[model samples]
Every structure is written in structure tokens, then in C-alpha cells.
Target: MDITSPDNSYEIVIVGGGMVGASFAYALSQSFGGTCPSILVVEASAPLSDKFLQPSFDARSTALSFGSRQIFEALNLWQILEPQVSAIHEIHVSDKGRFGSTQLTREELSVEALGYVVENADLGAVLNEKLKVSNHIDFLIPASIQQISPTPGGMDLSISTESKRFNVSANLVVLADGGRSPICKQLGIEQSKESYQQHAIITNITFEEPHNNIAFERFTENGPLAVLPLREFEGENRCSLVWTTAERESENLMGLSESGLISNLQASFGNRLGKLTSIGEKFCFPLSLSIAKEQIRPGLVLLGNVAHTLHPVAGQGLNLALRDIDALVTILKTASENQQSFGSMQTLQTYVNSQKFDQQKVISFTDVLTKLFSSKKLARIATRKFGLLSLELIPAVRKRFAEQAMGLSRKF
Candidate 1:
């Protein structure tokens, strides 16, 4: 709940109360039940009257894998979020103008839905409301961490608000800030980044035909394009589009008239969902693979994009981060029960050790998919063709691929 009077210390302090941070806080609180520790969340931006105006709750939509849905169900959040989501009954993957394509269906996985897509704003509203009602959490907004330093016992932080600045200490600090973090830079954390020299053109588009709850992943000579199904709006069949293209090409696409853009999209995407009727405001950002050099140190841990940012090819970025939150919360809960210092290297290392393989696998999977589909080499083209054919022809191969896409391969 909101705390009017600041405390000098907290058992846990979370930085950046965005999606990741808020999820972690809620999960941690639920896991501990009545014995929950004193938790504080410091967010730099105040909650806007309209969630859509918030940076974290903008027009973007996130594709949550089936496994991610299970995670939310465990947290008791799925019931509240289900109404705002569109379920994916099937995923269609193809190479543009290629000889092979494959489809993954919910029946094959024995699940009702393969995944669900929810607009960021809707998801943010649910999480923020939960934060405000949680008795164990002290929600602090319009507050910034001016400085963070290590102490013998834990970490010390200087927090700034509109009225005053104050010092607080915490046994552990969780950093869920976005990829571009000034605090990380101040703490001398280095990131290894590899730019793909491509920018993703993101916008919502209306189609003449219904999507039938099918998400499409199409690879073209330009780059990988994803069209995720969204709930109908105002009687129009809508879908979220992520089109990756070269830097120059993205600029050209952004400058096109709505009709011109629709024409170009029709040529690239074909008539799978019929004609593209309309386009929304276009947004673009460069693609990259960024991993922090260190995710865990004494008294501090990095979570979400602050730790690793991946390509948007398979829609794995947020799903993977959600899994990370599950693992971290479990480990911290155990530490709390055992009365061990959760911020100690031993405790933090245990969390890292448990998640190391999962993190690497997802990172590698996303990176490889981005590179494989982005290339036009003859050999790579043949390889992908065979890959798709194999997925269709072989049940074992199809099952394995579907598991990864549904985020069931790793058990958190």
C-alpha cells in the first residue's frame, strides 16, 4: 500500500516499478504470505491518470506464452487479466516465397491455448492496482534513487522525491530498470551489445479477414515479421505488427501514406489475413542483443531488461523475463524462510546458478533465430526450408519446437 511516511530502512528495496519490478514484488509478496518482509518499490515516474500515457503502459502489446500464463495463474493474476487478452489457438510460421511452412496448434500441446496477447496498458493497470492493495508492499512513486552504495550489511540508497531527499537502507536491492539505466552506468556495470543493423516497425493494423486466433511469423528477405492476433476493436479485425527491416528501409516505410504502407504490407505479407485495411501510428527502434556483464553482486541483483535484452523475433523477451522472476522469487522465499541474508553472495549465487542454463538457452535461441531468418544466403535459405519441413514431417521435432515457443521447455 502507499506509505505516506518514509521508513529509514526496508528489508527489500526494488528500483523501477515497471512491469518486471511490479511482477517481482507481487510474486515475492504472495510467496511469503503473512510472513512477508518489509518491501519498498521506488518508481521515478508518478502514476498518470491514464495508464496509456505511462511509458511502460504505451500502445505496445506483449505475447505471453502458455507457460507464462501458468505463472500468472499461480500468482492469482490470470483471472483478472484474462478478460483483456486474446488467446492464440495456433501459430503459423513460414518463409516468404519459400517452399515450406509449419503450424503449431494448441491440440498438439494438449493445452487450450498456445499463448495470449495482452496490450501493455491493460496489464500495467492490473499490476499497479495489485501493488496499491498489497499490505506488505510500500508503493513509492515519483521517487528516484539518487545513489546506491554497498554497506557491510546490505546496501544504502539516497532517494529523491518531489518534496525532499532521504536516506534508506535495504538488505537487498532489486534493479528492474529498463535497458538504458543510468544507475547501472553509475555502478560501473558493463553491457555487451551486438546491433543487428535493423529496426522494427511496430504498429497495429486492421485486416479485412479475421485472424482466427492465429499468430504469424513470416521471414522475408528484409527481416523477420511477426503479426500477432489481437482482440477485435470497434468491429474491425485488428492485429499487432512487428516488421523488422534495414535502417534505411524502416525510415522509408515510416514516411509512407497509410494506403502506401498497406500496399507494401500486402505485397510482403501476402493475403493470409486478407487485405490490410488500416494502420495506426508507426514506431521504430533498433534491434540488438545486450547482456549485462554481471547480474548479481553482494546486496544487489539485476532483473528484466536491465540484465539482458533480446531480439523480438520469437516474442521471447518478456516471457523469458517472467520466468526469471519466478525463479528469483522462489530462491528469495527460501532464503527468507531459512533466515539467511537474501543479499549475500551465497544466496544470490544460488539464484543465478538455478537460472543460468535457462537464461543462456533463451538468449541463444532468440539470437540464433534473428540471425538465421535475417540472412539471405543460399545455404541458410535451404537450411531454413528444411527446418520448416522437418517440423511438419517429424512429430518429435514439432513437439520440441512447440515446447520452446510455448515456453514449456524449461521448468522454473
Candidate 2:
């Protein structure tokens, strides 16, 4: 419900009501049913309206793994999201100007689709709409957490809205505010960061031919270029593009004319989707691997990019965050059943411990893939070539690769 002023206390307070924060609130509320805890979501930005658009709900699209689809299905949101998503029946991975290439198909995995792609705005709309009407959640938008301090029983938060400022307390405080989190710093949480020294150029491109529900990941000398299929727009075939390039090269690419940019992109992407007909507004951001040294402490926990920010090479960042949310919600439900404090050290630790392996594996996979594919060194190139060849020739290896890409590795 829309809250003008928060209550004095809550069971859980989530900072930042973006995708990650809102998803957790919805999932937690559903999991608890009638015995739901008092949850408050403090969002710094205004909600999406006819006049104002939430920045998080920009034009960019996210590739949701099959596992993420399952999570949303369990939450009863898949039906609402499915209509706006483009299913990926197959993924084509190749090394530009190289002999080795591999393809992972849904038919081979015996699944409906490998993954699904949805526009950020569409997904955000669904989540935000749910938040506004949720009976168990108090969503405070266009508000900020001015200060957060740990208490013996929980955490105390000072929040500021347009007309008023108030203080509230929670048994558990979840930090989902993006990577640059001042609250995390205030709480003395440190991050271990590694800069890839690369920038990702993102845009949507229209092609002459249909994509056939295929997503392409091509490793070029510039960096890893990904073209994921998108739902047709105005009767035109379109796909989302994320091209990772060096710091210097990104500026040059972003400065080119639309036609010039398409020409360069066509040269790198080849004729997979026929001619690249048109391009959208371009966006660029520096790539890096950033992980918080402490994800859980006392009555506080970190979620989303505040916990870990990864390379976009494998498109694992948001998917991993979703998995983390699922695990935390499950653990909290168990704790509630056992009559335990939701923010106790033991409970929070259990949530972190349960997701450690999955988190590590995905982080390592994305980091290594980014380095290996982005490097021009002879040794790295040779290793990747052999890697692709193995994935293509060996059924067992291919299955494992496909499972990871489909976010099913944890199942086995």
C-alpha cells in the first residue's frame, strides 16, 4: 500500500524498491501468507507514472534464465510477464574469425525454452504494480533512507519523504540499493572490486530477418558481443545488443553515426540476422567485478548489486540475485516456522551459507569467461578454441554448459 509515513517499527525494511528489492518483498509476502511480517520498502526514486519513469525501468532488457522463470512461476507472476517476454529456443556461441563454435538448443535439453528476454520497463511495471496493491507490504516511494544504524534488537532507519522525515526500526534491514551504497559504507561494509577496464555498449537493433528465437554470443577482438532476441516491435524484427569493448574504443563507437555504427556492428556480428536495418539510442557503462566483503552482519543483509556486481558476459548478474532472493525467502520461512528471529546472526548466516556455492560458481564462470574471451593473447585464444570444440564434440560437456546457461546447474 502507498505509505505516507512509516510505522515506528517493522519486521523487515528493504532499502531501494527497484527490481531486486520489490521482487524480494513480493516473494516474502507470498511465502508468509496470512502470517506475513510487517515489511517496508523505502525507494529513493518516484514510482513510474505518465510523467516520470523509474530509471531502473529503462529501455534495456534483461535475459532471464529458465530458473528465474520458475521462481516467478512459483510467485504466480509468470502469467503476467510471459506475454511481454521473448523465448530463446537456442543460443549460438562462437569466436569471431575462428573455427570453433557451439550451439545449445532447448530441444537438446528437453525444455520448453533455454531462457526468456523481457524489457526492463515491462518487468518493472509488473513488479511495481504488485507492490502498490500488496496487502502485506508498505511501499514508500520517492523517499530516501537518510541514515541507518544497528541496534541490539534490529536496525534503526531515518527516512525522508517530500513533506516529512520520520524514524523507523526493523528486525532486519535489507540493502538492495545499487552498487554505490552509502548505507553499506556507513555500516562499514567493504567491497572487493576488480575493474575489467572495459565498457559495455548497449542498444537495440532492428534486423531484416527474423531472429528465430536465437541468442548469439560472439567473442571478438573488441570484446564479447551478445545479441539476444526480443519481441517484434511495430512488425519489425529486433534484438538487444551488448557489446563490450575497451575504454578507448567505446567512445569511438558511441560517437559514430547510426549507419556507421550499424556497418561496424554488421562486420563484427556477420550475417546471422541478415542486414542490421536500424539502431536505437546507445548506452555505455564500465564493466567490473565487485563483491561485498560482508553480505550479512547482525540484523542487516545485503541483496542485489550491493552484494555483488558481475560482468555482463554471461548475463548472470540479475539471475544470480534472483536466486539469492529465493534462497533467503525459503530460509526465512523456515525460521518463522521454527519461531526464530528473522534477523538473527544464525538465520542470516544460514541463508548466506546455503547460497555460497552457487554464488561462487557463477561469479567464477562470468569472470573467467570475460577474461578469456576479451584477451587477444595466443594462449588464451587457444584455450577458448579448445573449450568451444569440447563443448560441441562432447555430449556430457555440452549438457553441463547448457545447464549452466539455462540456470539449472544447481538442480543437478
Candidate 3:
């Protein structure tokens, strides 16, 4: 089955050229041949968008787990990212509930570091740099898909840019288009989702005391607050923060002036790291968990936020997306080599089967943990607090939890 437009031909067409999509494209390229898989990436943001590739004046950053670091290393993208990455040597987790508190240290697990803290822009720049040098992938910058339809053989995509329209076809179509996946909606892939009754407010902060490579997670009556360490700020130490709270509370916080907000934060957060005198402007995202009931369809598949978007409370969203990239690359490489129909129902089903256990495990774990911690119930509050307190006393349990945060749990 030749799934290609007569004018422009390709073996795979990936929608949404964000980091996840780019990673998948690069992975498939390497698996098949250094420069073999004919691919096209359509991104709402330009494939070569400066938003991520430029320097990091942005307040946004992400905590990359060790498992994700290894995956990037395997993909040959980490070396490019190393300079901008900051290692997380320790983590402190505590809950202000009816029970007690807990903390996890990297030394307890005999690991060099728990994970790495990196700005989103830096990671994107590194990935874009690699994508530019790759001979295998073709990036369709700043393009939008107007329509997507399944053909008897594979799939058809109609993409429009400012100046032109591109009609593309591929043996397999990957809808990496994000949470509100237009392709999935076009294909009628059902999804099950729930709201977390919270919002995550992200910002960068310059602390009075040096972080000293320690990250902190403090849970209050509102929601969890994560303070992640950075390498060096100008000449002092700084940290990135993700403060989760209810929508109303989030709005009120965001409404404050920088100094006012900082003052309020210092009050609840305490002077654990001395005074937090300054903070970058705040960004807010509503919290929700979404899972596609069926990630694969007749001629298309979903990845990243499109397939499953989880609560950022655990910071596993991108890690899970990377796992999807790995599985898709493996399956596609084998199929392409065997001359098998890449878009066949059989092939898509196999990819879905391989990902089921791992995907479900992550979604369930994050969802349950988020709900358990967010509950205000007296009983649940006590149990969760006790759970944290108990783990604090047991060295082994605390180590295990840290290992999990490092993305070294049973499931990848």
C-alpha cells in the first residue's frame, strides 16, 4: 500500500513538531537508518520556532528524571543538553496535615544525583539543534493541519501554512498534537478525563540563601509546592517553583504584585532557605488528567499530551511521552524492515499493546497520588500524613520513593 501523495512522498508524517514529536522522529530515523525514514512534522509553533530554541529568559523549566536523562542520552540528544542541565542532589518532601512529614535524599539510594533541573527553552534548543543536523527528518515549520482522513492504504493530511497548502500522505500518522488533539477528535478517538480541582502556578525565584543543590516539596492546606534547584544565578543560587492550588486561590495569588506575592509566599513557605525576596512573573495552567481510551486507530496513533495528559504534580508527563516515543520507534523500525504495512490495524494494535501496561501504570499512579494528597478528608489526610511520616522513619522506603522520583520505578 503506497500511502504517499503523488507530488510529495513520505513514509511517516508526524503532527505537532514539539519536543516529543521531534524525539519520536529522530528515534525512528536512527532505528531504521541514520537518514532513512522520510518524515514531516507540522507544528503550530514553528518547527524551528525561536520560542524554545532561543536563550532562556523564560521563567518555565522542567525536572527531568534520571530515566528520561538516560533515554535522551541513548537518543544522542543529551550531550547537546548537558551544559544547560543542573543536577538535583537532594529532595525534601513534607506535608502539613494531621499526621507528619517525610524527606528523600539521593545519598540514601547510593545514587550520584536524584535528577536534573533544566529550563524548557534550553531542552528545546538542544533538540532543535540536533533536528537541524539530522539528515533523516524534514521539519515543516509553523504549519497547521486543516484536515486529516484515513485512506484505505494509510492516511491523508492537508496542512496549510501562511503561503501554501501541503497535501501529505504516510504509511503511519502520529497525532502528537497535544491535549486538545484535533486529529484524534477528527478520528473520533474517545477519551476519559477528570479535573484535579487545582491549578499549577509556575515561576522562577531568586532565593536569599543558596539552594546548595537541594530541591524541596512542601504540601500545605492548598496544594503542593515544589522548589527545584538551579546551577547558579548570576552569582547567587536560585530555584524554580511550581505552586499548585485551587483555581480561586491561584487567581488571587496571580493577581498580587511581584513583591506582594513574594511576601505571601515567604510567609507560607517559611524561611527554609532564608528569604525569597524576588520572583519572576507567574504562569498558570489548569490541572487535569486525560487518557485516550484507544491511543491507536485504523491509520493513526496518538502520542504525548494527545494520548494521555497527567497531573504535573509528579512531573512525569514528559517522561511518559518519551516512553511512548521509544515504543513507537521500536515497533515502526521492525515493521519497516520487514516490509510490513506500517499503518495496518495489526501494527497499530501491537504498538498499543506494548504501551498499555507502562502507560496505565503511570497514569494510575499519578492520578491516585494527586487525589490522595489533595483530599481534605480527616481520615485520608491522616493516613497520607502517616504514610509520609512512616516512610521518613524507614530508610529503605524513603530511598525507594526517591528512586521512583528519579524515574527508576518498576515500570519505565
C-alpha lDDT of all candidate models, in order: 0.90, 0.93, 0.78
Q: Give candidate 2 misplaced runs (Cα > 4 Å).
A: 48-52
Worst 10 residues of 2 by lDDT: 47-56
lDDT of 3: 0.78
Of 1 and 2, the candidate ahead on TM-score is 2
State the lDDT of candidate 1 residue by residue for 20-93, as single tens digits.
99999999999888999999998888767756524666778889999999999999999999988999999999
Best by lDDT: 2
Candidate 3 has its poorest 10 consecutive residues by lDDT at 1-10
Candidate 3: tens digits of C-alpha lDDT, residues 53-97: 422224578888888888888877788788888888878777763
Q: What TM-score, computed on C-alpha atoms, does each candidate reach?
A: 0.97, 0.98, 0.93
Candidate 1 displacement at residue 405 in angstroms:
0.8
Who wins the TM-score comparison?
A: 2
Give the local distance difference test score of model 2.
0.93
Model 3 reaches what TM-score against the true structure?
0.93
Q: lDDT ranking from best to worst?
A: 2, 1, 3
lDDT of 3 at 109: 73
Clashes of each: 0, 0, 0
